[model samples]
Target: MVEIDPADNTAPPAGGKRFAPLWEPPPAPTRGRPARVNRTQIVDAAVAIADERGLDAVSMRSVARALGVGTMTLYSHVPSRDHLIDAMIDRAYADFALPDPDLPWRTALETYARGYFSLLRSHSWLLTVNTWRMPLAPHVFDADEAAFRILVDTGLTANQVVETIGIVRQAVSGFARAAAAEIADERDQGTDYEAYWSAQTDFWENTFDPARYPTMTRLWTMGAFDDAATPFDLRIGALLDTIELLIERAGGSGTAVPSFDECVRMSGPDPAGCADVDTADA
Candidate 1:
């Protein structure tokens, strides 16, 4: 079962006015018996269903059954399926731990990326949702705020700040999505990424034309195929290096900031282990 979000915010969300009803729930029914559950409870139940089975299994009827309430009873709380999903996505995002304001900018992003990637893995069903249509819910905006806050004080301009955050977030999103899709599909497919790829071993070892793919052939010969996965920080640290160059180009302190390796090493983990960040404490 999924843990329920403890946020009791009652203020209207700042991003989307039409989504206000979800943020500001309906007043308790004054004419009839009060609702058996509030909107949060309904959303929590639906999230549970989605987590266990998948998003496709989370409909009004399925959630109603999980909550031990009738289908119409859910309608009173969640006006529609669209409303429920928008709430669900935000609820999952609420699990993200925002960076502490006192930390250095690179450290803050490290904290944010690790936490966000774990959240995506936990709720991999989120990958299937049409996120383009997802409402600009409170937590979503808060996440965007956390990213902006990290870079706002840098000498980079507004456009640079936005692009930098977009790039970092997309990196986390794309990598985690590739990793999660393999795990989630194992439910019905009965084979994971490693197992599925092993099927092509014979062709790769014998039939493949190494002359046509020189670099890949070299990598394969070096036992690089022994573990095809690239470590996360190797890529992210390189990104940080580029961003540092950008900061220097903008007349800000670039090399003054500790490298990802330096900060991470000071924080007491093996540098390579940064890729396996367990952000429960984030």
Candidate 2:
């Protein structure tokens, strides 16, 4: 038997130092029952609601209804409406199928853009998906990580890579949302964009004085042509080209910008030469 020391609270009976309190761990967390709400399932239900009725239609109550659970149950998984939207955005991002790493930066970036566009199209409410200043989720960080790796390999600084990724991500989502809005507008009006443009042109011709607006008259005539380049292509292309130029100047290369000849060729193939048909801002 060990000797006990009166002054040492931890000493053993025979004089070996006591170890019970010194080595004991705090108790494990054990509440009455495990949490009933599954966070993943709650987010999934919210995404389904957004897909069916757009993001505006999504509400905590609505999601709860869809899940056949009480609103309080959802709150157990997600804190607020904003939190739900954030979760929905991440869930939508989870749908992206990442490109191969072996591809060149240009190809990889384009693949990323296309994959993102497809995701937005599938989840049209993506425009409302929050990309807060500080994103905490896995999907958000995964994209940033992929972009950082790809751009870093391209010889860009960390800040440059981050800036470039932001612009690219915005461009892809903006393009998709713009296209979705245009399509939605046309569907709501029960007429195609071309028909609406014709009506607008008739109004323009009737309201404007030709002598005072020669330039407008000239543009109107040229714009009516099926062979004319559409404004959508021009604007979006111009914006992209401007960014490409910036990147080129900043040390990047091999941008796949379309040549004028290529544009002409593409226009030559389409029935209306949709190239000439402006999307009224798509």
Candidate 3:
């Protein structure tokens, strides 16, 4: 984990510094004693529990056990369970590669949206975290700043930039949440989707009256549910297309943004393409 100085007085232009330095490392141990642990280790342990068992399993006691320390010792580093959760959320966001600024606004947004969806899917418990209750952490702020920076320079007003990013973020999160639910359902059933749905064929044929539900019968016959990815792919593509239209209506050329490949090359050696772009201006 990166250490930031909590005492630093510098503030970003956006709204007088609403978040504290939650990722800062703990004070070093005194002489003759080994350093017990750091905030990063605690957050990592908590996140591991959440990823393996689920969010509800991530109590301070559980994390302390995982770290081979007493539960009270965790408080000295994280303050509380809520603060530990905030750190976990921030750590997840930090995993994201910041959007390449040189890419066109659309490409950059697409890349970010896909990455966000992937993260949520991988860590399904993340969807359960109440983001509204937690102060913005550095990694979360970095994502927002990168998205805003890309869209802000494209002739959109500040409000428009904010709204646009909100739309994209909501779409990605919503889709990922639904996908996670579907995955959980399958796991609980101990069967794949096709096998489970096939077992319900008798119910559809007998209970679902064909005369009253013509479209339903047609869809069942066509095996529409067999390919879950089609609907998700189509919806995401349509959403991106609509956003492009909105940009054009605002008198901005949708093609003006650079390609993802170009941004990668510009970032040389680092595939994440997160070179020092001014996030504060966003």
Candidate 4:
């Protein structure tokens, strides 16, 4: 696990070079004694509510009530619900144990992917939040920086690096969502994935049509699904194989970014071409 820099906890990953605090302090409550509530207290309360009751349950009034304060008072620290959610999402990201940059690229990436999936299961409400609004914060950058650094020495091009990591993230999110839904179903409806699937055994044995899903029917007959990894490690292994293929396409050249000529052809006299891009060491 990458030792997260304590200075920038609970920030979004890779927002940009210019980072800003989500909300400034409310001027220290310049009258009637000093204020007691801080941003951490408010955000923590909000996160707890969301984890237990879903994101929609986390309103300003609800958070304030959790903290034994008035709804208006929360605005002093959080500014608005959007800002509150921004903090909440970043805090959740902070729990991600960034992979060690020194590990093999595949090892580091697999470690990172597993950690992210576990974190999501712990805070499944995060899947419902519109993470597009998540802010650019240091915590966000630190985790991303570690993950990117892991692939820095790989024979993948700059474009390949971006695409590779994006694929890994999507795989983790998709798998985590599916697994989390199983737990949710069990909790909310007393039927987890296995139970729900088993409940349909009668239909599968008596009335299920094999001609419409011949492949699935065959796989089912062969017990293909029963021997699968719990979270389907097969999926991640396939993703790593795809990343390796991209690296092999690099021809074993240590070149990270595309050649200048390649960039020029892609840019074609655009003024804000390479200068605007962060193709490391290019």
| Top lDDT prediction, candidate number | 1
Candidate 1 lDDT over residue span 84-124, tens digit each = 78889999999988899889988898888877777777787
Q: Taking the tens digit of each residue's C-alpha lDDT, what string does model 4 give over 65-93?
A: 89898777776666566667777877877
Error of 4 at 69 (Å): 0.9
Per-residue CA lDDT of model 2 for 98-201, tens digit only, reads 77888877667777777777887888887775565433567766766666555654534446667877888887777777777777887798877677787787
**Global lDDT scores for all candidate models:** 0.74, 0.63, 0.70, 0.71
lDDT (C-alpha) at residue 140 in model 4: 68
| Cα TM-score of candidate 3 | 0.73
TM-scores, one per candidate: 0.73, 0.60, 0.73, 0.77
For model 2, how big is the CA root-mean-square deviation?
19.9
Off by over 4 Å in 1: 1-17, 194-201, 220-235, 252-282
Report how far off residue 153 is in candidate 4 (Å): 2.4
* Alpha carbon deviation, residue 169, candidate 4 (Å): 1.2
Model 3 clash pairs?
Answer: 104-257, 104-258
Model 4, 261: alpha-carbon shift in Å?
Answer: 22
Angstrom error at residue 235, model 4: 4.7
